[model samples]
Target: MIEIIPVDTPSLGDRSYLGTDGEVAFVVDPQRDIDRMLRLAERRGVEIRHVFETHVHNDYVTGGPALAAATGADYHVNAADPVAFDRCPIEDGDVVEIGPRTRLRAVATPGHTFTHLSYVLESPDRPPAVFTGGSLLHGTTGRPDLLGREHTGTLARAQYASANRLARELPPETDVLPTHGFGSFCSATQSEVTESTIGLERRVNPALTRGEDEYVRSLLAGLDAYPAYYAHMPTLNRAGADAPDLSAPRRANAAELRRRLRAGEWVVDLRSRTAFAAGHLAGVLNFGLDGNFAVYLGWLIPWGTPLTLLGETPGDIAEAQRELARIGIDRPAAAATGGPADWAGDDKPASMPTATFAELATVRRHRPVVVLDVRRDAEWRESHVPGAVHIPLHELPSRLHEVPDGEVWTHCASGYRASIAASLLAAAGREGDVVAVHDDYDPHAMIARFAATGGSGLARHPL
Candidate 1:
């Protein structure tokens, strides 16, 4: 039986491993979580025999070389790309045998990248499965705009032709496993569910719905904004940038932390809510170093923001730094210079009380603290805390003057954006106390609690 293990991408959930016949494994579109893949292999008693990249990714850092080095596996890329590394260059019709009954056949499927290929898994008795990296997705094909305008027209046309070819050529019953899901930026439409079948996609995927010209035009429309750091990724991947050394986190003490902070270094705390609430350094912004940590941090910390990391454990610190590096936020000024206790100083910002739903209700009953909902318009419309100011996190810096000077309770779907907004407010020397609301709790109860106190009146409902 072939065991498939999905490695969570920093934000894009498309990285996975395909283990063949219980003893040999092949990984596809590996995220930076090399250890997770290793652990999966250990659990299954398999050795990773080869690492295959369908294409060079721009959405997140690739782990092909890192995993290969860890397991001494052969790294494979398309022969056409001419990657600068010792790798097995696979081309169409080349079959890599993994066991007595299992093999992977390379199918050249370009357009996403000039060298993109999908691996067709062949077993003796079952329908084949195609690991269609970015080439084919559930509702769409991979975007051809990665090559930019210089070749977008030509490449997009080529991509459409490739998709049409795959639609017609691959077996109707073949399973399709893509490298990106519905929400991923890699494809114009990433599905919430990650995998699909070739036959299923051919019937329902809009990108494959029409003729070449119409399909190409559909892809070009409504393409989401690429991450700011995407331009740097191609170079980084090609150069095989050094993997983050998780064993060694930058060590610092209270003095160094203070000096770095004063010297314009930004402190990013990557800890769980419970851990962060228990204790943390003053003035640090919390962007928990967990899943999607890189994507969120990339948004919160501007490019070139000198960074210092704070985490609950040693591992957390290293993981946090690695996530930052994945999105090209590589400069880690230091990490946990001193434990929270030792770093307490007058410079530490006073810890503002966070409101529970009940407490917020009491405050709102008597007086209402300005509630700034930092979620986007779509999110706010779906559901929001009543009597809240709506300013998406991205616009907070420019719209600072809109928020009143008094107490301001900030919230997003979760506390991540709220924390970022609060930090921005603090940095601006705003007089208001910034509080983050836990999304799991009821917002109405919190608002009622605040109202009961007659603490402050809600005013100036801005459109």
Candidate 2:
């Protein structure tokens, strides 16, 4: 029997697959932390024989080279990919035999990248499974704009043709396994569907249902700014990343934490948003472990800045380190594990106020405050609180001066980002008065509360 398992890196919204026929296995799109893949293979009692890359990734460093080297597996990458490392260069129509029953056939599916490939896993008496790394995703296709805007139009058309080719060529029952689209910005649009098949995709996917021009137009129209860290991924991926060194970072005391903060280095707190808002070391920012920690932290922080992590436990620090490493953040300068008091030393930990939308509405009735929305441009353009100043979280570092001085009330789609913004405001000496709206941004409720109080708190923006 052939067994396929998935290794999910939920923090980065990507998945690597292990396909095995009991004794031997192959991995697809492994992340930088290859230890997990090793442990998984060990547990499965399978020896890895091959590692495959659908494309040189643009979201995170691939663990293919490291995993292959560790297991003495043949590393398979597209012949067209300009990777520096040695690989078993594969091309369209290349078939790789995995075991007696399992074989992978490469089908060129260019769109996500110029030379993307989808591997079809065929085994006897079972439905074929297509490992579509970044090309064909669940209910959507990979974004064509990652390479560059200059290549977007042509790549988009290629993407449409590719998706159709897969649909027309593959049997409807083929199980579709993709590397991205579970909150990864690699997707053309966010996909809510957890699992899909070629039959399901033909019925629901925009690329399959809509005409090429309409699909391209809608995909282009729906595009938003991806994470800034994404710009660094292709470089690291091209030069084949090694296995991440997940060893504990040098321990930092309270004094060292204070020194780093004074030096304008990033001292991140990896606790929950609630814990972070309640009390954290002054000058420390909140990119809580409970949220999209890597994506936002990588997006906001000046790249290559010395980073120090403060977590409640060693495991939290380790987890953060692994997530950072996937995005090519190799090592942290230091780490501290304990409560706020432990990290604060003699200095009293600073706290920020967190309120709900109702509380914010009530406060606005009595006083004037700067309502700052830190969601992305797309989110802001969809609908937002009326009269709120918009600054996307990624752009906040450079655009901090644009925010008018006042008692700022910060919010995002969810409270996670708002907490980060609140911490930034606190670090900027706007503490005590800056309230984080730790609640879901429900526009209807916001409109009702403010409408009742003689104002419109929410305004809808036209597309």
Worst 10 residues of 2 by lDDT: 450-459
Q: For candidate 2, lDDT tens digit of each residue in 93-177? A: 9999998878999999999998999999999947888999888899999999998999999999999999999999999999999
Candidate 2 to truth, TM: 0.98
Off by over 4 Å in 2: 452-457
CA displacement after TM-score superposition, residue 143 of candidate 1 (Å): 3.8
How high is the CA lDDT of each candidate model?
0.70, 0.91
Error of 1 at 463 (Å): 20
TM-score of each: 0.78, 0.98
lDDT value, candidate 2, whole model: 0.91
lDDT, candidate 2, at 145: 97
